[model samples]
Target chain A: MSAAAARADAGTAVARVRGLRKSYGDREVVAGVDLELFAGECFGLLGPNGAGKTTTLKLCLGLVEPDGGSIDLFGYDLPRQAREARQRVGVVPQVDSLDPDFTVSENLLVFGRYFGLSDAQVKARIPDLLEFANLSGRGDAKIQALSGGMKRRLTLARALVNDPDLVILDEPTTGLDPQARHVIWDRLKQLTAQGKTLLLTTHFMEEAERLCTRLSVLDQGRVIATGEPRALIAEHIEPQVVEVYGDGVDEWASAHAAPLSERCERTGETVFCYAHDAGPLVASLAAWPGLRHLHRPANLEDLFLKLTGREMRD
Target chain B: MAADAQSRRTVARASPWRLPAFSLRALHVWRRNFLVWRKLAIPSMLGNFADPAFYMLALGYGLGGLLPAVDGLPYIAFLAAGTICYSTMNTATFEALYSAFSRMHVQRTWDAILNAPLSLDDIVTGEALWAATKSLFSGVAILVVVWLLGLADSWRVLWLVPLALLVGLCFASLGLIVTALAPSYDFFMYYFTLVVTPMMLVCGVFFPVAQLPDWLQSVSSVLPLTHAVAIARPLLAGEVPGQVLLHVAVLAGYGLVAFHIALVLARRRLLR
Candidate 1:
């Protein structure tokens, strides 16, 4: 069974938000969001730019006060008892906010104090946290001297300084290279194994599929769909996709797209053919000899595009 | 009845005045800045001393050589007290504006801290106190210089520490208010030109407020730095300042009122 399936239904609700609403001027950033975060599960919020992912994360933390609705985190009321709730929670923001003046470990040491941890307590945890982030001997390295990936790992370690039960990461690997991304994903998977509930936001479908047991797709300030990654793909998208691209792809799409596929979409120079059965679509694609085609099983990206639409969102 | 309740909620959310609740958590914020400052303390102190050292040498001694004593004191001696207040004001203002704004907006340090158990109130209070503490350091440093130069030999001069602290607190509070409203570093230029510089000139940093026109002296009396200098100059000369309560009251009032307003504005700016 998937981690989300095993944990979500049986798990206690560590955080609950009902009909949460927030607005900046006339633009409603989080329009009536309802979420229940189960303990020991990595729940993801997937959205394009400005799809209210960051705003929703902020509202959940009580960093932004909601215009309407109620939030209960760790059984404490939000924007009121948020401090108490936050004592048990940790957050890694969308953008890094590491103190450039302090060295790598000093950053963790200082941040841990905000959670009321004694200096000795934080100092004791620093070595292990650094080792966890794979920055063991570089504790004295300044923030500016560290590479982008190293800084992000240090940030992840900093979030774990208090040993918080819930860790919220906003697009933790947005600008990272593949190697760096894999390193962070490995760390996050370990966090879930440690039974730390994680709520993260991301624009990467592969990241969501790899790290999250379940996730919610947000668009235009609303959740369009929510389910386990595989379940969501199964429910929303066709089982297979044949993407035809290159020269004469449009002509090939016009000739064979409707006749041979369950559904079709055109984006730029490529046409995606979605079908329940891959055999017939693969057979049909052979007739278009000049066009290059790729056949693969549908995944989270297909589900995301299907639910949030193919329009480019900024 | 429901509409009335809804409107009241809006009013409460947008209230202009609020009494801030402070906690010991603020000290952590203070410690954070203290740790950062400790690394660059030597160079930072050098930078703070350079500007005032130039002002004293050129304006205090050079200009004093040309003019007679003003207000029963040598031009250098009179300028000494003014330098303490003025330097404290600049130190407090710059720390609260540039450094605090960098932590709040540019570096997103406040955003990170807010996500922790600390509230915005704790962060703002800690910032204001740290700025005041640094200004107190600057003010007392000038007091030590004046003492070594044999400008004032009285025990009454010890009042400079608490007085400098008051001046720091008042100006720091005012600077934070501007920081909460500022969109970027460029916004601070307007504040420096319009509010800070004008007050420095009229509040008798380089000269006596009496040297200005009667109308200008009236303007000077209301400025926070003027009250700072009013108490400081007399105390530095081994005399108790007249209306001591009044001067301290004005400084504290500015500090307290501006701090409250800073909290309110910060809420609007940050807690949207």
Candidate 2:
């Protein structure tokens, strides 16, 4: 189904960012970015650190103003209409911001009240949100006493306290262990299943692959590629990849595989060969003795490295 | 189609009340803060009381026993009023400055609050009100303690509570502005040591501003705390000074403009 149709038949954009830009002094942090998210679309932003994904999210959420261009939430201009727009939007910040003073349930109740939810309305939503976030048993626990993963779950639960239509999450699982990551992914999927819109930023290729339906690959404050996650990889890079690592892989790639394969790129000590099929590439690489070889399906990282170039940016 | 249009209009009309919605959230956070740190209230109150109490005992009793009274009042009454004035300033200033910074930056509390329907103005105004509440409570506590000790002799001293609240508005607004500008906690200490601490000492809270050097008296006249102490001191001594109205007006002027400045800075920090 088209993205718009999947969005609860609302036929409206939940968030629209046009030519958004943020700069600190002379350095442009988010440069001329444009994006649109419809309800029920799980839109992922994939980038390395300092790629302006977080800055873009902050601007869209009105946490920070854009240096240039405009952001609209459900058609309301962001800065001038921030309070109005925020009423229908929720944000799960990269850093956990749960109130250490309140219990998990109190935190939800207080935050829900911020959106003008009455006591009865807030109380009614608590049990479901607690279960969704896996915090049903710890609803009375102090935020300070909760583990990092629990805190992250509570933060996510807090965002939904007001039943926001559009949810913005900035690197929601950056430091989480594998189990924690999956739990969050499940909750996020459930949110989308309820026809809620989501905009997320992540550096983890695997997380984006598992969670995001549509994604934009951003590098140096600009979009490098954007489409459905699978389509972007298939359209831009090879379907299968053969990684050959040795002291002279780059030289070997240039002499042996550059002309034969669709593409050959060097990342660190490994040379990744992109081809429609890895059979010929694997067979060819076996002739070169003492060269390490590993074959896997080409994914977002290959597409990302292909577009952004294989330089050690950090 | 007509039904959909009506629904849209209803949403548009309800937009302006969003800030009050956020302010209510601030009150919830404040209540939660109180619950978590129930032990903190007594210590914080003591901190507010101890400074003035020590100064009053050492200066009013020990020093006054040596020197003659000012305006024919016992040194204890004179110093009790001044101590309460300075305590109000400290209570309001500390809550708005250090505690606000921690909530805004370290805890990321404001970010979460703003994500709801609350505007930047609501967050700041709520903070100012909470600080003012703390100051007023502290001042009243100090008044009761001194009254029990037979230090505050005047029934008119009850007026100091309201006057202290006015002083709180001034310091709370100023503290919010400082919190918006402060980059880190250490920066706040610099403001406390160099700016706020001096304002407390020289703002007619301890000695009469009239006895200060000509230039120092001129400088104290511009401080809101000086005006606060001016009004509060006369009431505590059972003398209703005619110029107290002028002090009230001066404090009101500072309160309005300081709150405006704080709102602008909070917008820059939270939204820009």
Candidate 3:
């Protein structure tokens, strides 16, 4: 809340969105979301798929018009002042958009020019950008020849070509392998250390927990919860989780555990209990034949499952 | 009173316009895809140049052998001017339509551009300039091949280059307007087959519009391509008319108005 309040200061609020409402015909995508992102801080948007995280980012960037809302980016009202707002920001979309025709350095050079950088300045930044994206030796490679990880890194490098004050990355490492993800994470850490503000959206709870200082959990186009990760785990959910495994565990939880636990929920083949201490919960799980399996501390994944149910929808 | 002044000062400080640093972002993007233009150059010329050669070889040589000349000029030369006009149209239209559409929709280069200090207007202007440049190149290619074949009838026909560019401007602007409205590539195919292709064929490309009914001839006279051919065909045949200036004015007007329309549509599609 202090961070949110600090963002109310004119100098701190890099992006502010209030009462955002959007719908595709009768189906509302973003019902009512209020958000403020401060300068020099990282904000992560945590949600399940189809939770309007990308839509919210698109609305802020003026790519999609909201049904109703006001977005102030660097003090400029969107989309009337979209050009002004856009000048200070950079974006890495979920899809790779590096020009297939251009080589790596050429791609960065061209993108920098859109920000109105001079030819000399564009050339000057190429070395640093190539090194930062781990693409220095591959500057001559065509975009079509690059691997998925390479493309993702190049996309990220392209976003920073203009030296933007604010960077928005949507699902930055969704499909990459562990090595690629770690490399990206290291670069992102360096960026944050430089005091450049970031806003990220990801369904990967581990990514959210790893990078974000403050986060919001969104479900069904609504902000279900928002706070620091540790605070959220402490306040709205249990610090420790005990998962009992077996078929008919739901029936067992209903009979033996539901009455004893603070919050006991069931998915297929497993029953989860959220409580202050898993020590007592583990002992309690030994009594029920169906609850033979035991688990340790809970995390954001458990929190996500607790808030958004296990029912599958197409 | 000092506190009130301080609050007023804070309110005044919340202005939206930031200092614009117009870097060379557009030029960098241009250089990145300049090679694509080089690849496109041969294909574009081949695509446009073949139209006149095919019609002249297939229709003019084959059909003209069976029939008399309509207005005393060789049928090859008549079809030659029409082919050049259609070449300009095809080059300008394709560059403005499919290529621009992909950059805006698929590549998301429009997103890349708008993120910089460049506005929607600048994007459209840059695209139009680029398309015109491509069209001019294609026009020159066709003019050269035609002259080498000794089909170019008049020294006055050299003016057809600028006139062809005018035709390109008209089609490119219209094509850009279509690109702004076109949702998918499939949507674009409909306009090309139905509107643009038919307009080229019926607007006196190979045969005289006078052979058609009087009203259809009148209808063809007002279209931008029609004036281009009217001015170009006569010039290519060693004839010049004061009325050609009227054609120039109409083409210029179309370019300006269509350009503005394209800018508005781009702004709506982008900023919204």
lDDT of 1 at A42: 93
Predicted complex 2: CAPRI docking category: acceptable
Residue range A156-252, candidate 2, lDDT tens digits = 9889887877888999988898899889998998888777888999978888888887899888888777789899888988788888997667667
lDDT tens digits by residue: candidate 3, B1-272: 11232212211121112322233343444454465677566666667666556666687678877777757777877777777888788888988899899999988877766656666666676777677766777777777777877877578978988887788888888899899998899888887988798788778887888887888888788778787778878877788846977889989998978887876677667654
Instruction: Rank candidates by DockQ, best first.
Output: 1, 2, 3
Chain B vs. true chain B: TM-score per candidate: 0.93, 0.86, 0.85
Sort order, lDDT high to low: 1, 2, 3
Q: Which ten residues in a row have the lowest lDDT in candidate 2 chain B?
A: B7-16
Interface quality of candidate 2 as DockQ: 0.37
Q: How do the residues A1-314 of candidate 3 rate in per-residue lDDT, one tens digit apiece?
A: 23344354424778877777778778788877778888877799888888899889988886666767677898897766766777778888887777876789888887876766777998998899999999889998999999888899998888888777789999999899998998888888877776678899998888888888888888888888888887787677877677788766766676767655678877877777877766666776566665477666678887777777777634
Fraction of the true interface contacts (Cα pairs closer than 8 Å across chains) found in each model:
0.58, 0.57, 0.40
Residue-level lDDT for B122 in candidate 3: 65
TM-score per candidate, chains pooled? 0.95, 0.90, 0.85
lDDT string, candidate 2, B1-272, tens digits: 21232212311222222332334555655554565447467677778767667777788788788767875667777777778888898888998998888888888888778777776666777788778888898899888878888766787888888887888888898898899899998888887898788887788766777888999889888988888888887787678967877889998898878788877777766664
The best candidate in terms of DockQ:
1
